[model samples]
Target: MYVAVKGGEKAIANAHALLAQRGRGDAGSERIGYAQVRDQMGVLVARVMAEGSLYDPDLAAKALLQSQGDVLEAVTLMRSYRTTLPRFGVTEALDTAGLASERRVSATFKDIPGGQQLGATFDYTHRLLADELTTPELPTDPLTPPSGDDAMPRVTDLLGVDALIEPDRPDDWTDPDPADLTREPTVFPMSRAERLQALSRGDEGFLLALGYSTQRGYGNNHPFAGEVRVGEVEVEFEAPELGMAIPIGRIELTECQMVNQFVGSADQAPQFTRGYGLVFGRSERKAMSMSLVDRALRAEEFSERRVSPAQDEEFVIAHADNVQAAGFVEHLKLPHYVDFQGELVLIRQLHREFEERVAAARAEGDARAERRTKKEDSHA
Candidate 1:
């Protein structure tokens, strides 16, 4: 079905062969193994996985290696490969409240229920580039975790106790049938679930810019980082044969909940509204930015005036995917000889017409001068 066109087939094959060779840097350098890349370059692989919408670390590592460390290319490779794999079923909604958090912090509160645990974070460090990869001091004994159940309650739970922030879900909530973006053609006015899915897979830099715009009076979202948690949560799935949900495995996830002050609508009483973000792996910054933009897009729901690009749902969701954007932009590299020729022909014709108009105007002015001279001579 995917047979190559006859013209330049050998050239195309050779180009790809050369590209594969170049993936291994300069001569005499040892080739980087997939294991080393998967382990050492875990963060980059996680980002690729997030955008790619796939969870396989090995495939992401291979893609990264093949693409020569290009993130977008790796994501494209992962996305393309995903289409070939068959989907079994969707997983049940994850319970993030029971997450075994390694890093949890609350910017809104001085004291929280579990006490702030600053686990494995670069937030406090003065970011200076290291001149050398110095050996880390090895601990004599393995560090023991605090003796207790690791499942800590979310900060929003505490806020709900005093009725400070609005509940994330209504008391009489039922799971709505969500759309599969991979299959369905996008329709405008997408559901909150769809918007969240798109934004989660969106380019981080794009969302960060939009989120920053909101903070700078574009969307009027003065958001407080209620809580940011990085932890491992169990993923569950319901099997038809089993007839019950079972925990399949655990995945590291980062969640951000933003609290924003909202003026009460005519029907509803005044209360703090919340924005939520959840992403694969330890991506705190992405989670925070996502939460801000997510709330801003809900301007209509909150009955707030939408005044910024971030608040425009269609614009945000449509342009979110980097691969789509790159395809639209990079396609210019292909042959456009006919299109270019058409433009040149039109431009040249327009120039000739302009010159002719100028010449006609000049001739008309000369005739008028001659008529005026003759009239003046007759009067004298």
Candidate 2:
């Protein structure tokens, strides 16, 4: 009886129906349209797209609506939908240098080319809520148009001019095609490219915490935000038959380059090192955290001590997918009747054995005491 288990089909059907009804919200409330979710909740949509590994904002908005704002569930929905879509050839590498920059800033230098443009940030805002919920007009600042040399050079380029940092692509460094993680079984000893791909799809909160751990002395990572630029970058896919790369629209990107101090090693001179992070949409905070974690994970490459979880590649990469982690944890809500009964039976048997042993020991002790008293009385 304990070994047998049954599932309630009617109960589950009704439960699912109730869940669907709740997902629709109260009948009187205004319906959340796709445009509202896609635009107003743009940040959340960006997050869902990033973690879902699907760059479709409309679908992400729909998933959010279907899941009723449950981020993990929405991500799962996106991931599942991605499996149904036909994948085309890989796109050419994105040229972030040519980004139509929206917000650009540098912690290393205040004075930079193209200037520090604070485009749509809550950085200087007071941490207080307004009395009424109202949409305010977006203010645009009048600025001088860019000339021939108004293009912003990378911060790393400045360092490279003086040889203050190691070259990102060294003389002998070869650019091999990165493995397609979606199709291939993830092998141990993942290349930097593979690690980067995983990090891009990793959970924001998980990466943020690990990045914070590095700052708290968990790893040999004290980094400076050398540069963080958010902008739009065009994606182009090469057509084999046409023999040309066709533009397939543009996507917003957040790129962060982290600069960290490096002491001289046996084979190298003392110079600053860099960690690069790029993510979909204008997610500067996530990009920054990812950069920190990226540098921390490069402890082996930099010949630094690996003493933290952030620096552990396997540990970080394996647990980064929130959907997988949630599925493992959330399944506990499902009925484990048979399994629970097995545990229950074993525990009860153990308790009975323990009580019987205790009783036997007590009886033996009492018998010994009575025997000793009788022997004493006989002797007396």
For model 1, the stretches where C-alpha displacement exceeds 4 angstroms are 1-7, 138-151, 369-380
Judge candidate 1 against the unseen true structure and give its global Cα lDDT, from 0 to 1.
0.86
| Per-residue lDDT of model 1, residues 80-131, tens digit only | 9999999889899888877777788898888777778787777997889999
Worst 10 residues of 2 by lDDT: 1-10
Candidate 2 structure quality by residue, lDDT tens digits, 50-122: 8898998999999999999999999999999998999777899998877777888899998987778787787
TM-score of each: 0.92, 0.92
> In candidate 2, how many Å is residue 87 off?
1.3
Error of 1 at 121 (Å): 2.4
Q: Report the backbone clash tally of model 1.
A: 0
Which residue pairs clash within candidate 1? none
Per the 3 Å backbone cut-off, how many clashing residue pairs does candidate 2 have? 0
